[model samples]
Target: MENNKQPQLINPAELFNPEPYGFSHSISVKSPFQMCFISGQSGGEGENHVLTDDFKMQVQNALKNLKIVLQSHSMTFENIVKITLLIVDHNQEKLEIWVAEAKKVWKGTFLPTSTLIPVSQLALPGMLFEIDAIAVK
Candidate 1:
């Protein structure tokens, strides 16, 4: 089976650089034979399902959880075309942490086109970050 890869990145000179925010202006995909949309994933897990307040921890765990979901769906990071991040109390510091965690997750691999959405709050009170993904194959 051919593993669909990250979409083509589009960054027009007219638009400001989106790299700092860990996203692109747009991404175009050609062959999306199959598509999967995973809902926003949070950092909390296990029986207690206790969410962490640490932004970095939340970013890490959210990506990890997304990985597991993709695996179960027979997809890898390459198959992901886009990722949406919802950050509570978003700021430059949080964006940096998110980019750092993303580098770790997609190390030596093509980074999926991503979007970071700043919001006042999330589903849970303590949740710091939530990530949702769209994959193709």
Candidate 2:
């Protein structure tokens, strides 16, 4: 006789150092859906878009831009399966602030896979951070 038991789903967070294995750093879902890839987004409004010279503000704006892209596809952060963050002048203090801001948006629910990278500089001056996201819908 064959048993018909479903396998337990794995949350990416439960995995250790998922990046080395080319997997998300956290959270995964079992589903058949389409994936969406968003281009790298920076924090700015227009040609004169430099709003705040602060790292925290840049991080916030980057998240806002990410949200806009997701909304355009009728999605939200909950639908995000993977994200890559690029930062210039990376520092622990900045990361801590960024994490705090992210908590406001994510609220410790539906943790998505993510990667953070430190870079020398972004394409634009006065921009401290950029983010790209992949979503399943």
Candidate 3:
């Protein structure tokens, strides 16, 4: 039987609220649908497979790549339940940029739960940002 109960959102008083950043502190989901975990996407294009140097550009391309993956699997942004964002040399400015870009793609649907990680480097060189996602149907 499919569980009809929805996941409860929790934001502890001790922790700061992160709703403005296009995500929540924590979320729970109890569903009977299949869950899809998409691998981290990069910012590369064409035959040369060149990664973008600009942070904003990379952010956009990475999201575009993610969209391709979602569509390929017969899903869309609304199906996403969680996300993990990794940014190189992260800072408040970069975070602001990220949130702006994220808001563009996830303009609606209450924004999915997310986690942001500041990392010094990624698996591939010259990758400014990467995003992985989890979606449930």
Worst window of 10 by summed lDDT in candidate 2: 6-15
Q: Taking the candidates one at a time, how many backbone clashes does each contain? A: 0, 0, 0
Best by TM-score: 3
Model 1: how large is the Cα RMSD against the reference? 11.9
Question: Candidate 1 — which pairs collide?
Answer: none
**Residue pairs in steric clash, candidate 2?**
none
Quote each prediction's TM-score. Answer: 0.73, 0.72, 0.73
lDDT for 103 (candidate 1): 82
lDDT of 3 at 119: 97
Which structure among the candidates has the greatest lDDT? 3
* Worst lDDT 10-window in candidate 1: 9-18
TM-score ranking from best candidate downward = 3, 1, 2
lDDT tens readout by residue for model 2, 15-48: 1332444543122223455466665666775434
32-125 per-residue lDDT for model 1 (tens digits):
4656666677787643457777888888877777776676556777888889999988999988998888887787657788898999998768
Tell me how far the alpha carbon of residue 74 in candidate 2 is from the true structure, in angstroms, after superposition. Answer: 0.5
In angstroms, the error of model 3 at 56 is 0.4
